[model samples]
Target: YCEKFCVFVVSMDRSFLPETPVPSSLSRRIGGGHWDKPYNRGSLMLRAEISTVGDSQEVSSIHSGQSRLTTVGDRLMDSKCKCGAKEQLILCKSRLEHLVGDDRKRRRCAVNRGKLAAAGQAALRILSDDLLAAVTEAEAEMKACAARIIQEELVAGQLRESEIGIVERGCALGALRDKVASLRAIEKASQEKLRRHVDRREAERGSVLEQLHSRLAVCNELRATLTAIKSRLSLMRHRVRSRQDSLEVARSDMEVYRKVLDEVPAIMVDLANGERETLQRREELERRAMALSEEMKEIDTQIASVTNSRAQEVGGRKRCLEREGKELDQLAQRLDAMQEYVGDCQQRRMSGSSRL
Candidate 1:
């Protein structure tokens, strides 16, 4: 039967024939070429459902604006169907339309059911989070009150009834009740016993007076003992005072020790600070010494460079002095030759004049 139902559902027209009028619910997502839109979740679900519940073959017949009762009627109805084949087919078509229509209602019902469940859960959560503790407490308090009331009722019920019995309990209660004759007998016996007890008490009282007199003598002996104890107590008090004074002196000494202990940390701190400062100064001195050594190296390099430059200048000056000294000797020999040539020229001129 379920297979038939599935086949029937799967055989319905689905392909949304070009001629099929658009419903308002589906128009937003499924549109003509001019109005395209993405399918929403609902539209997609509807499409999937339609595709599953419909066939391309049946779409033509369903959309053909006419349906024959003979087409699907014989296949859909049970063997017990008494209706005519044509009538059955019409009924089938009507049922199909009704089922199709129910799809819309089903969709709405699903949405409503989901909404109701979500709302119910939200309300339940709120109640659990905000009110459950208080409600449970109230219920517990009510239960305790009920239990207390029941317990009180049980305890109250345990008390025997105060109703006096005449013949209800017959002989048992009758015998147990105080009777006038028995009460009179009991009274007479009680008076006799009380008289005997009174005479004995009076005798005991006389003996108690004699004991009291003996106690008075003992009390006089205790009085003397108390005086001696008082003297001892005074000595003890003096010793306590002395001990207290010693304790005060010890406390003063402890205070001095405490002061010394308190100063120890400050002294240690000062020593530590001095050590740290000394270390810092030592590091600074080392750094300065290193810097001075580097400067001394630079000074030594500069001095070496200056000495080399001066040596080059001295060598150049020595070469220049040797060249100047050779030039001076050549000039002196030339002067002597020129002076001898002039003397020869003068002697030649004088001998010529004497010959003329």
Candidate 2:
């Protein structure tokens, strides 16, 4: 009686207990097998419910110790009890395959014939109630599981969205960084170009300034040269004025000389006439002198012959002839004096002509 009581109490407790989650091993086995298929979930739920019902009925039967209470519940439990885990799984599969078809046929036949005994009707109603309760529990479990899955999916979706946003922001930051770097490089290049241009312009400006300074110095030199030229030109102008004065004096002297020269031509003609007359007289005198020289030469030759002849005959007459010879020498001297007077006259005439 104690054993029966204990079994009855355990069965009652099991029936009244809140449904627990499936064991990890049993669920893993089911999940690892064909139960992994989504379409088998309903069958799995039905099998679980049927197994619970069978276990409860088996416990109750052990308490009652009666075979007469044996029904579908005992049959299911007996089939399960006779097998190991794999066989039990196969039996559960076969029962699940026939459950829907058999229930439908039995309900249809009972309704059509109206031949069901009260006990059978009552058992059917009880089974129907149990099936409905199991279905409701399974539906509730499915709804809770679906809600949990949806919540998990929502959390996973949020995490994925955050990750995607982070990735997109990182990509944007990288692009922005690259753009900034490019902009900096461009700025640097532009700055360098500007600096070079400025330096070039500065060099050009400096060169221009230097050129301007050199040109200014050149201009100063030119100004100094111009001043010196002006001074030299003034000096030259003064010298030209003096030269003009000298040229005017020379012109006046030349005019006086021209008048004197015009008057001197008549004087020159008169002198020429006098010179011609003097030349005739001098020629006549030269002829006379030449005749006298010939006569003196003949006299000298005759005296020489007389002296030779008288040398023997006239010694006393020779003294008298010497006195006569002295007289003749005095006459020759007189003729030479006359010749010198003519030569002096000719020289005076030449001097007078030259003066003219």
Candidate 3:
């Protein structure tokens, strides 16, 4: 019984027990129900033994008849009491009773409460931290997505602007090309017209050159004829001087004959015959002088007519030469204008080529 009781106490307080087993008498008392009544003397002694093993409430409730037993056991244990008594056993028993009261009903309740409280607090802290981190991460992701969307929109707008610029430049270049083609066509037409005008001018110049050559030849022939007429007129004036000198010599000789006839006169032979012969001689001499004067006047009139005709021919030739000169000047002006127009066209062509 004592060994059984010791084993039960050892099991209950294993954290405080030593390596040794309990006494055999205590083991037997623990196993038997004969120790069930607290007032029985054998049971009271058993309670005392149980109190030494820390079963305090059982010892306190035992019979008062066992007080001496308890006191003797206290002395044998040699322990001090709180009441200034040398009663180690009694003090140990009273301490065990106090510890085994209704307060010790559930032995592991307090420790379990502490562990559960700690676990709950740690779980609450972890959950709060995780929630805050999730909220922050979600906000950051939303901001990044918004920024990317804005960048894409900006790039799209720039692309649209570039496309518009390209289209406008293409349109402008096309218009310029059309204008250039029109100008080239107009220039080609003008060149054709200019060529025709030059050809016509050359034909007219050739005709005028031929006419001038013919007029020059006629003028030279007229000059030669006028020189021959002037030589003939000089010879005729020399012959008229010789004739005047011969007439004067004849008159002097006839006067001398008249003087000789006067000296032998006074005899009257035939008066009517002498007077008729003298009158016939005077009429004949007067007729010869009058014919010579009339011939000289006719010659002077012919010479004047020839001089007027020569002057008219010379004046006509001079007038024609002046007209020809004026025509040549006009032709020169036309040629100069054509040259200037050609130069302008060449310059325009060069400029157009540079632009291309």
Give the per-residue lDDT digits (tens) of candidate 1, residues 1-356: 33444555444444432233334543321111111232233353356456645333343365575544432433444345554544535554565666556667767865674454455445545544544555565566557656755765564444223112212343443443334346546655755655575566556556655655555555565556556646777767666576677757755755665565565557557656755665675566557556655755665586567558656755665575566557546655654554465454445433422321
Q: What is the Cα-based lDDT of residue 223 in candidate 1?
A: 56
Compared with the true structure, what per-residue lDDT tens digits does model 3 show for residues 1-356? 23433444444343543333333432222111121212222233334345454434334434344543454343333444454333433454454455454234322443453354345435544544654554565456557546755764675576467557656755765665565456556555645654565456456445544644554454455446446545765776676467556535544543543443342233122333444554564465446445644654664575466557655754665585566557556655654655565455445434432322
lDDT of each: 0.50, 0.51, 0.47
**Model 3 accuracy (lDDT, Cα):** 0.47
Q: Which is superior by TM-score, 2 or 3?
A: 3
**Which of the two candidates, 1 or 3, achieves a greater lDDT against the reference?**
1
lDDT score, candidate 1, position 28: 28
Error of 1 at 336 (Å): 2.6
Tens-digit lDDT track of model 2 for 239-324: 65766677566557556545545645564565456556556655665575566557556655765664565454344444645664
Off by over 4 Å in 3: 4-155, 192-196, 199-207, 214-356
On a 0 to 1 TM-score scale, where does candidate 2 land against the true structure?
0.26
* Model 2 misplacement above 4 A: 1-146, 231-233, 236-356
